[model samples]
Target chain A: MSYSPPRDRLWFLRRRAYLVFVLRELTSLFVAWSAVYLILLLDAFADGALPAFWDWAGTPWVLALNVVALAAVTFHAVTFLNLAPKATVIRLDGWRVPDFMIVGGNFSAWLAVSALILWVLW
Target chain B: MSPLRRRAEPYLWLLFGGGGVVSALTLPALVLILGVLVPAGVLSRPDLTALLSNAVVRLALVGLVMLALFHAAHRIRFTAEELLGVARWDRFIALTCYGLALTGTVVTASILF
Candidate 1:
């Protein structure tokens, strides 16, 4: 027999950072939801039921679901980008990039791409 | 236990990290076009059907979905154990999460290709 410590299931709530971590984990569901939505888009495209795609996506509930999923995915992306430098080490010419530089560059690139997409669509 | 189980963890983790990178790089832009701009009628929907009709785009979409799905599955599997304290059910958790991801990947590929 070995000793096992009893722990609260709500341990995540006891600390703010842990809560953020848990929320980040929960974002996985929405990430999967986005993938599912993308699958539907591809399926509709493959079958040439193109109008069906627009028609279904236009539904209020679908819009709402997409809105929620979008929010979650956005949070996931932001958190991951902010956390990335901690998990990564980039060196150029035998010099490591500073953490702020890495995070700032990641954010700058994200903004540039987002602007590009919006620009093209507009 | 499968002989590959222990060895597969690191690779799966790599996939998760790669997927996170991919999601960060692509999904926000997608969400902006899809979630906010289009729905708000600020940006008109382009020839998305024509755009995605390209084989390369379809393949890329499949890759994105596949990796994202696996990343979700791995993260959720651990989250389930942590939140629910279901460590004793690790095998069940892994099977369910990974199985769903596999199904999603197959369906994504079949539909895309």
Candidate 2:
């Protein structure tokens, strides 16, 4: 006889952490959305339709959806950075780097990169 | 695992992980700028175009789009399999997801070039 764990499609809903995990997984869609939206913007820009693109993007509903996407991507970034230490173990002079250091370093780098982009674009 | 998947798994995971890191670092600022600032009329056309016209910027855009799309495709494929109970169609799902990503990559590269 073989034993197997029961499969529950809605198992993620059973726990807060599981729900968060699922939501985190779901953020990939928003990440892809951002990519596709960027591609469209580039296409419009190349085609000399900047004004039209702006008009379409500036509509209330599009702006609202982008705001939600901003939130989702931000959540994804935070979670990804927090989990960075696990994937990126470091050692300095034979001493193991602590997880807090790794997480903090990642967050600091993220802030610096964001600030640099803002400075350049602004 | 199938032989093809076995050979491609590492590369897929690499793209997924790289995309996660790259998008995590860049997407928020991008969304804030183009999605929010530009839409709000805060940025002028010249400012945006000047940035886009840079060769380095165009290259980076291509890289970002390619990696991000692959990342999304890989995650969505697995999520659909587990969450939607479509594991039996794993090969087909993987193909569709990656095919779309590849198409997006080509489109982005062509637009930039």
Candidate 3:
């Protein structure tokens, strides 16, 4: 006979951290959503339908969806960046770099890139 | 693992990690700018079109879309398996997830290029 461990479908609800972890995983949906949205934007531009696209995007429901996606994607960004230190370890002169430096660097790069994009649009 | 599966695993993971990094660094600002600001009339359409017309900007947008989709696919595949108690069907789940990502990539390329 084969034996398998039992699984808890409600495990995520059992702990706050677990819930956060699940939420972080769920952010992938919004990441995909953002990608699709961008493609739609590009399609609209290509079709010379920018005005229609803006109007559709500005609709209450669309705006609401995007607002929620913004929150979810932002959460994804923060959580992923915070966890970067664990995945990427750097050393100089055989001295391991501290976690804060890695985290700070990730955040700094994030801000710099975002600012550059915004500046270009501005 | 089969030889093909083993070889593809690292590359898939690399795409997942690379996508996470790219999406983390860019998605929020892109969402804020394109979704809210521009649609709400805070940012003008002409400005956006001008920016998008740049070859470098279009290329970056395509790259962002491709990577972000792959990242989402990788996470969603594992998450669905664990959350839904369907790890036994991982191969199917992975195929579906990655297939969607590939479709998105193709659609994005067609639209942009």
**Using DockQ as the measure, which candidate wins?**
3
Name every residue pair that clashes in candidate 1.
Answer: none
Please report, as a residue range, the 10-residue window in candidate 3 chain A with the lowest summed lDDT. Answer: A3-12
Candidate 1 regions off by >4 Å? A1-5, A92-94, A119-122, B1-3
Cα RMSD of all models vs. native, in order, equals 2.5, 1.7, 1.8
* Candidate 2 residue pairs in backbone clash: none
Q: Which lDDT tens digits does candidate 1 get at residues B26-59? A: 7767865765556556666567766666888678
List per-prediction Cα lDDT, in the order shown. Answer: 0.82, 0.91, 0.90
Report chain A TM-scores, every model: 0.84, 0.92, 0.93
Comparing candidate 1 with candidate 2, which one achieves the higher TM-score? 2
| Runs off by more than 4 Å, candidate 3 | A1-5
**What is the C-alpha lDDT profile of model 2 across A2-105, one tens digit per residue?**
99998887888999998899899899999999999999999998998988998999999888878988998999999999998998889999899999999898
Instruction: List TM-scores for all candidates, in order.
Output: 0.88, 0.94, 0.94
Fnat of each prediction?
0.63, 0.75, 0.80
lDDT per residue for candidate 2 within B6-113, as digits (tens), equals: 999999999999999889999999898889878977885435778877999999989999999999999999988878898999999999999999999999999989
Q: CA lDDT of B34 in candidate 3? A: 88
Task: Candidate 1: count the clashes.
Answer: 0
